[model samples]
Target: MAEPTMRALLRRRDLGLRLVSEEDALPADALDRPLRWVHSSDLADPTPFLSEDLALLTTGTQFDGLDGADGYTGYVQRLSGRGVLGLGFGTEVHRSGIPDELVSACAASGMPLFEVPYRTPFIAVARAHSEAIAAEAYARRSWALDTQRALALAALRPRGLDATLAELGRRLGVWAGMFDATGALQSSHPQEAIAPEVLALLGDRVIDVLTRGLEAGQSLAIGAHPFMLFTVGRGGQLRGVIALAIDALDPEARTVVTSVIAMAGLALEQSEQLARSRRRLHTQLLSSLQTDDPALARRVLGSIPPAPVVVAVAADAPVGPLSDWWERLRAEGGAASFVAESPEGVVMCVSADDEGLLDQAAERFGIRIGISEPESYSAFSRAHSQALAALRQESSGAYRYADTVGASILSALATDEARLVAESRLAPLRDHDTSTGADLERSLRTWLEHDARAEPAAAALGVHRHTLRSRIAQAGALLAMDLSTFPARAEAWTLLQTARD
Candidate 1:
């Protein structure tokens, strides 16, 4: 509720207050100055005892001995300097009317001066203002209650979060906006109400608050506009922030904003829950596709990314922001894509034509992504494997399967299946060495490393050339490979590298 203004007091008929000072002499907004209370003091110097924003009601007693304009001018100046809103003189009490010297002094000083008829006591004028203040307070409380009800109803709309925010902005007569966890604007009421520079400043403040990972509110001003920002979720798990373009809020208006914040938090929490459920469903669908059954996935999910899609795997990515991004994409009727959480990390499959989407996600989330070559849905599992391999080679940004093809053959063979095969192929020699203490596997590996040269291979093994040759022949017998041939030597060298990797 607004404090009672002097103009409101003059409008009260029962008070019988009349402005005696020339209206032209007063400041244009003099009558509209808010009055804290009305005070009556006849002391020659009432400035020491009076507070600001109040009317000093006098009965002319202070002017009884005043004989010069200097005294009157000093008195009016003191009152004005003390921040008194105006002066009210009780007429027909100590004098027949207001002293001419006092009226001239008030007009010269640009102080509002009024006459209170003796019939209407100073107490009556004070009571009128008190009642006005009370009535305004009551009206504001009623408005607050009604606005809260309207906001609650708005929360029941189809798009409850957006509706609630719009209603809040309308009710408070200010712009309202919501920023996502990523510090990006998610929704705003009266869109485009904020200038670009101010919006950028707001975004910076929002990010600062979010980075603190706390549940708190901030009050700040950008240029001429003031804003109040509040985090919309629990501490350490903030979902987003709500910003109101308001300088200050009365208690009632603050209560209304609190209600809207609660509603928005609940809506966002519900959205997070729904996103999690949808992600789980997507994970299941992706699992079906991984089993080489795109039809089953299609039957459950209605559709999947078209054939000849690139599978991408991302590591150390924040799930909330990415999930929110995906939800926005679906809302905008963008291309269908499959995304899911995996033991490796987050996996996504998009049409090869939409490969830029992966780059966008990578840039937005600061995550490293590895993408596979284009392949049909029937080869989903293979593409997935290729994506995993690409991910192993990725240091940052998006690494594609095609890029890995030119990498070292040793790196290419560094897979779980390759390691298993390599280990199995050399296991017989390992078993023979373990049983008889014959270092056959070591001899064969050393011989392959030295290009099958008997002297250097034996010297490196710290054994005689004849003994090294015998160990290699024994290893060859156990592995069923001819040790002297280039094919056998190359295969042995490849297996050693694969096993080491």
Candidate 2:
């Protein structure tokens, strides 16, 4: 015969029975078996004999008389508070019937109490509860199988990565995210807060789970956020992990998590296979930059990335929105690849597949971008190392982008040179401009700062109209640089940025 659900177990032949017990029943489900036996006796609290193994069965036995059952309420109350499941009472044992006090407490505390007539055997009741639970298990298992099959089918479809992720999320009823081993978000639930750190951590968790051979459906919470982590493999080889997160999920959601991980692993495996050539190209490109062997490097880099490239290193903390910043970059017609340096830094490899896009990104990224020349892909090593040096050499938090040839030259402390030369050349003027009386220097700085706007700069400096104007010209002469020309102004700005400690 099929088992029954808990709801069915609670609705047996008892009615209006006192259930002043089971106040502490733990909210747990039996994975293997439903509860079976219950015993009811007139004993003063037959609780002492049975320990952890058996649940207590009770009835209004010896409690009617003060001689043996005095203050029986406390005994039942304590047993119920200790998490005893159901309390039983025989109606004929005492004409008074089950205690109303016990039943009321049980309901308030979420515990169930059962009443029994002399004809209903406690053993029979236990059998009914066990049978009910078995039925629920069968039903859940059947549902899981159906959901799994549906998810596996969708995952095998030929949707793009974005489409696939969206589909996977819908099927799973939670947010789905995929990130590379390095933690860069390859795809995430659209418009989500999948940051670089979160992406990397998800990858790490997947590897850890698979390496440990954790059971597939096991889940745990991270911080306040809940996640289902899976060790995924594709085409018979493991690729990366996928994280499914949300508050408590329904059974359908849980099933999708399991199926999607399996399918996504296969998808990723196939993708890597299909992308072997592109990956090789990327590797070759990066390799060309890493080495000093020009003959070998140039051969590998070839004529790819016909446009120039630039490298940028995070000198301090990253500022503003990375997506917005990176999107503006893509709009510039450049290809952007990101890698984690550590918690402390990030690096961006920027190249103009189309120079216009690169220009647009530069304008919108709003960070001091560095520029580099059209070195073969093999030149990445040299570029990255040089970029790091440039990062350190420049102001700690300023942005540095390699400029075509200018980047390699400026980045190389040796052949590049000039940080010192630029600093030295501009120092006398720096000092002279500094001592121009606080009022004068302030006025000059404001004027230069506001593009020499007489009124606006004057308003900012809080100086009289004429005082602000005179200081601007005198300050420019002292600095030995015209305050007007684009080049002079740019050089001055660079000097200021470069000289800043």
Candidate 3:
């Protein structure tokens, strides 16, 4: 806050510069202007080289050959227009004393004029002002460094992001909020001060910021609040944004804000690194579960449950916060519950008792879940298939448990088992064929294929209609199972198809 101003520089007694303008002419407010630099330009037109808020020093040599006071007045007018803090005139070289024309012009134009004594060199004043500016800059930088360290420490605490944002809001004396890559609000301090519209605006602008690579801090207004948007990232790769409702136009304040931005970037990187590590672990666990080696799967899972395990699959839903789902499952299944990604969507492995948690997650995230029957670790592959089948059958907003009986049960059976079941159901015909060299199995398949129509079945079989009917009757008698009911026919048909598949 202690900046180098024109009045402060003039109060230094070492330079021996005298105030030439009247006390009434130079108001206290005029001396309070912040001095950017001390420039010594003897040129008549130094406006091109000069910038605003600078103290300009000269020897009055530019006006020596001019005839009238207009030249001197014109020089003063140009200096005033260029925002010169004040004019320092050396009296020894160009004339005997300060020129009356220049003094009258300074008074008339209301430009502060001071006389630089013959003993003091312009270089000395320039060095003094430069040193003062450097000191103020160093002070601000040191303060900013301390603040950054404090913020980093705060970020290490429990609920760290919230703590860090709270500390930042307190430091900047404004509402501060942090957002994730998805523009989800992660944390905020003085939360009530942030209007809902401001968060919406933040979400809207983050897309533009990311797409256009607007990584720099931008000042924008949202409803009643003037917000400062800082994209948090490194090397032009954005991870998140930090919004502050503070007027950070001051150079020192901006430096502090820059430090905060850097901290936010580091925090985001750390969080993302942790997430990547977790994902890698989850993928490894999923791979182990899918492998044929039960030993390796057991090793990866750390333990095998005495109770049967069920796998629940939730696919093609509007993906919600993964952390919420994970926490929900852990709440029911303890730490042993695993949530991971599947080719279809997200997959969860939990005990049968905790399978219902998948229903809660599906309902909350607007997804449909499929729960597989309880199975051991060795049958995880089968359970996964069952869950996928259940998920495929679900046509509404609720979860569906994989059926363990009837035609739906065929989906969970291995190809070999399906073939065995199909052959066993028609074993009597096969045994009879072995003894008598008959084709009743083929005849039965043909009859079922033609929907029990004797004419079409006989034509497809290249046999007489009476012969096909006699073969079908013989097979039904040999099998000793009812073939008239829909359920019996459907079961036979499903088993046969399972065998073919």
Candidate 1, 1-501: lDDT as tens digits: 566899888878878899998787789989887788888999999888999889889998878776789999999999999999999999999889988999989998899999999899988888888888888889889999999999989988999889989999999999999998988898898899999889988998898899898686688999999999989888788989999999889888989988888888888889889989988988877788898779987888787778789999999988768877866786788766888999999989888888888989988778989899999988999999989988887379888889989888787777888889999998887878788998787788888888899999999999999998888888888889997889988888888888842
Show where candidate 2 strays beyond 4 Å: 1-8, 12-43, 48-56, 62-64, 67-70, 93-96, 100-112, 160-173, 184-225, 231-240, 246-259, 282-501
Task: Encode model 2's per-residue lDDT on 404-468: one tens digit a residue.
Answer: 23554424533234567666756666676567534444555466678867888778867777877
The C-alpha lDDT values of all candidates are: 0.87, 0.54, 0.76
Better model by lDDT: candidate 2 vs candidate 3: 3
- How high a TM-score does candidate 1 get? 0.79
Over 110-194, each residue of candidate 3 has an lDDT whose tens digit, in order, gives: 7788888888899998998998999988988787777778788887898677788888888778888887655566678888887
Error of 1 at 85 (Å): 2.3
Model 3 lDDT vs. the true structure?
0.76
Question: All predictions: root-mean-square deviation over Cα?
Answer: 6.2, 12.7, 10.6
Best by TM-score: 1
Which is better, 1 or 3, measured by lDDT? 1
Evaluated at residue 262, the lDDT of candidate 1 is 88
Worst 10 residues of 3 by lDDT: 318-327
Between candidates 1 and 2, the TM-score winner: 1
TM-score of each prediction: 0.79, 0.49, 0.53
